[model samples]
Target: MPTTPAQPPVFTQKKLPLLRTEELMLNMGPQHPSTHGVLKVVLELEGERIMKATPVMGFLHRGVEKLAEDGTYHQFIPHTDRLDYVCAMYNNFAYVRAVEKLLDLKVPERSEYLRTIVAEVQRIIGHLFWLGTQALDIGAMTVFFYTFREREFLLDWFDQLCGARLTTSWYRIGGVERDVSQDLIGQLRYFMKEFPPKIDEYNVLLEKNRIWIARTKGIAIISAEDALSFGLSGPTLRGSGVEYDLRKAEPYGAYDQVEWSVPIGVNGDTYDRYWIRIEELKESSKIITQCLDKLPEGPIMADVPQIVAPTKDRVFTNLESMIMQFKFFSVGFPMPKGEIYCGTEAHKGELGFYIVSNGEGKPYRLKIRAPSFIHMGAFDHMSRGYMIADVVTIFGTYDIVMGECDR
Candidate 1:
């Protein structure tokens, strides 16, 4: 036994240039399943903790604002449907209201109620989407199937409302395109009764499951002040205990006329946001039920003959009605030369539109203050001190849609 042959003394450098700890950069998505749409998030990480996060957008840009400038006010409704396709009715409702604000046009009471019904339906659809995807991101696949199934019924309701499902273009400048029928009302009544229980089932799966709580309980906490400073609205803002819902704060459509309350949260974490959206699902159901019960008995379209399209019978039988319909569709009604910004409580947040009119059929310049876009800006701010895994939770809880964000 050579008694551990002590070869030469090896100089084990005691302080080796302070182990250069280079930051690790990671991109979450531009084509990810969890991200619903094309969203590339650049994350700077040290081990599993995040330092800085930048959300890279424009992957779904269609020059929507510029497209608004080129198209007529009515023509842009379909474009808006493409913005937040998961909540196309809300998109249609928001843009139409924005254009109507420029014209100072009055929507009929019946039309307002109808708009509210569809808008709330869109809310349910949007939140169901958020819930399913968020749960899926956290490794709960059953929630997605359950939510999307209920959502499909809502889509069919939208189809009955506008003949198309996703981009229904149901809402028009002064009013909605079609009125809800007795059959549709019956369907909603059935859904309103049946859906609350399903939400409970979802809660059973996610509300306090060990894995869910472990992953989301303390992740991505946003303070009330920081939430407002970040321009967050809808569930994200309310989840921070702000009670700053546009539906309650600045009532639009039949929101002021109706009797429903906006839900608020206490923790402002992922779980709080999740709970807020779940409550919103109930609130939205209540709104739809009220709208259906209090459904007015009058015309759905506004009195603005220049803007609203004539009925098909009127268009086919009468010469003046035909010409007016043609003129309205071909050139569109001219609005006052002014600027107006109108906002609505969309599924994600306060989806708003600012229109600059040149006394023309089309807008001079149009700008969208999309909540998804604004919410994503706070990513870098909110995800600073959280772990890299928490960044995904933040994105899910924030509920961003790249179509709306990029546009």
Candidate 2:
């Protein structure tokens, strides 16, 4: 009976296994709206936070470099238009400047000033396009319309300057395709006068908007060292406070003759890049104005008979000039057996061309240092730890165009 006495029940707690989670893989583009082009990004995400990003390029690859090898130097100017098609003039300018360096050609003084003016106009157009599209991406709709409104004017001016608006092959190897008429100059001067306030209007819409500030500030930050290491140029590099601009550093065109300052940012974030571009719009306007006021009177094309095309009047009137034109376009000019790399300050970044010549018309080897492609190299580095939503902003911040990226 004592042994059978009831004993208190004993209790034990059971341990549960820890929950295991798997990361997610997301294909953001090649079709998605925000990729900026036929760009595909493989994002490894953990609950809406991006862990890694891999850019899948070549969707728009047209083997542009190979094409450069197949054609004459003069024939390739239009091809450069297809790369960064949004800002074709800069591409043309960069490519021609590279070819000129290889040929050791000297552009006329008037041609230099003209090239600078048109280039700055192209710069403003580029910045406007960037601002509009970028603001639209960030949920600010009004800014888009405003920026594009001004952009339309410049594009129309482009049409007047060169028959084409988007893919204008207005740049020549030693100079420009044609001189800027007085009427175009007058219109551009008017645009310069009106463009500053319009930039302010864009700022008014997003500069103080709480949502835009929250979205852009403290996002996608890169230091000056990293920027340089990554070979970032233009506003992207300047946003990191690096004051290296080919226009000023190398003094190409009339950049040295102009009195304008490069904008530097204290914090290398999306906001800083945006701010830098905004300031650049103003500086571009100032540059255009000065270049116009001091526009010299001379021939637009270099006097290199072999490389430069003869004037239309001469081509029509003189039998020898007609034959020369035909030969220049057909067989192309002979280049010395050498290699050269020339970097130009394009809208997106440093648009460089490294060409190897074999005493032939076509390039033996051609390489393009496209900013969109180079900037993509740093995408995974910059996008780590940011939210998935921030990817679009990062893309716009780079002002990426896949036309050049995949090429």
Candidate 3:
């Protein structure tokens, strides 16, 4: 709990008793360090207590949903990368899986296993970022260095798997761009084997620290009902004890093949949300290692060559293959003129794409159910009655990225 700052006595007439102090309107950031991205929270405060918090958005919006209408389905892969820029793998998986569902395509078992591997890898990677920065927000600075250091290792593995580090359009409409090299698999296997001790180190650093507990134990508590009613998911929902992980509740990819536990919180406080992410890091490692062990030997790309990319020899030699190479990029394939909703459990929450197709090369309507956007909706409700300074902790725990929120 933050101590309220003492206010000077205000005399209206002849040294009379103090009247009500004027409420202060404080804007936290478009540049504040504690913000996840370019987000500004307009807070109405009386002394140190926040009466209202309005999150102003649209700063990073590049009209991604609108832009999707102008391009072919294959052309929109790069757009999903910018939504949750940190965990682009899952975004790629989510969008591609939605298209796959529409196409009624069965991805190869090998591709499913590999997708699950990278998805879990991104889960660990994303939460590691959240753990480090969220702890740093509450004054645990060392965690930032430790977490980002491991993040670099993961990024190197991603770089090897795909060329790009951050905004990787690695996953294709049917499958990935290429097969996972054995070298990359070996690197990931090594990481899965050795990552547990690192998580233990993060726990030892701040799990029981007095200052961390005082700052986060009960700060920004949201009840289960409110969390659900406000459309929260991911750790934010699980923190409130809702067992609603899309992977577990609705299995996709190779999630049904793997065995894991979803960590839940009893208190639904900042600390529980923090601890859940740490536990998820361990669970993610387990899933990745399991996928590595069960990885199948088969084609990485699907059999649908009209939508899937063909071999270079085929593209160079065959006239039909040449036209497919052109049409796949210039104009995409058509669907059955129906609406479908598919989502995957991305790093933030239930990242869904609702696509209404008019049997055209492009979608008639496309909307992204970005968890960052949904979580920000409850900002004012949660921040009410908390000390103004605790707003930093609340914001950190939700892990809002303005790119995703504003998109």
What tens digits encode model 3's per-residue C-alpha lDDT throughout 331-355? 8887778888998998789999999
Better of 1 and 2 by lDDT: 2
Tens-digit lDDT track for model 2 on 1-407?
00122222222324346856679999998897776789999999877778899999999999999998899998999999999999999999999999999999999999899888888888888998898888888888898899888989999999999999999999998888877777988888787887788788888898889999999887888888999999888898888889988888888998998899988786888888999999898888889899999989988888889999888999999999999999999889999999999999998999999999999988999999999999999999889888888999999999998999998
TM-score, one value per model? 0.93, 0.94, 0.95
lDDT of 1 at 313: 99
For model 3, give the 10-residue run with minimal summed lDDT. 1-10
How close is each model in CA RMSD to the real structure? 9.4, 11.5, 4.9
- Among the numbered candidates, top lDDT falls to 2
**Candidates ranked, most accurate by lDDT first:** 2, 3, 1
**lDDT per model vs. reference:** 0.84, 0.88, 0.86
| TM-score of model number 2 | 0.94
Model 3 whole-model lDDT (C-alpha atoms): 0.86
Assess the local accuracy of residue 66 in candidate 2 as a C-alpha lDDT between 0 and 100: 91
Q: How do the residues 237-343 of candidate 1 rate in per-residue lDDT, one tens digit apiece? A: 88778878778877888888778887778777777788888988988888888888888899888887888888899999999999999898889888889898888
Model 2 stretches astray by more than 4 angstroms: 1-18
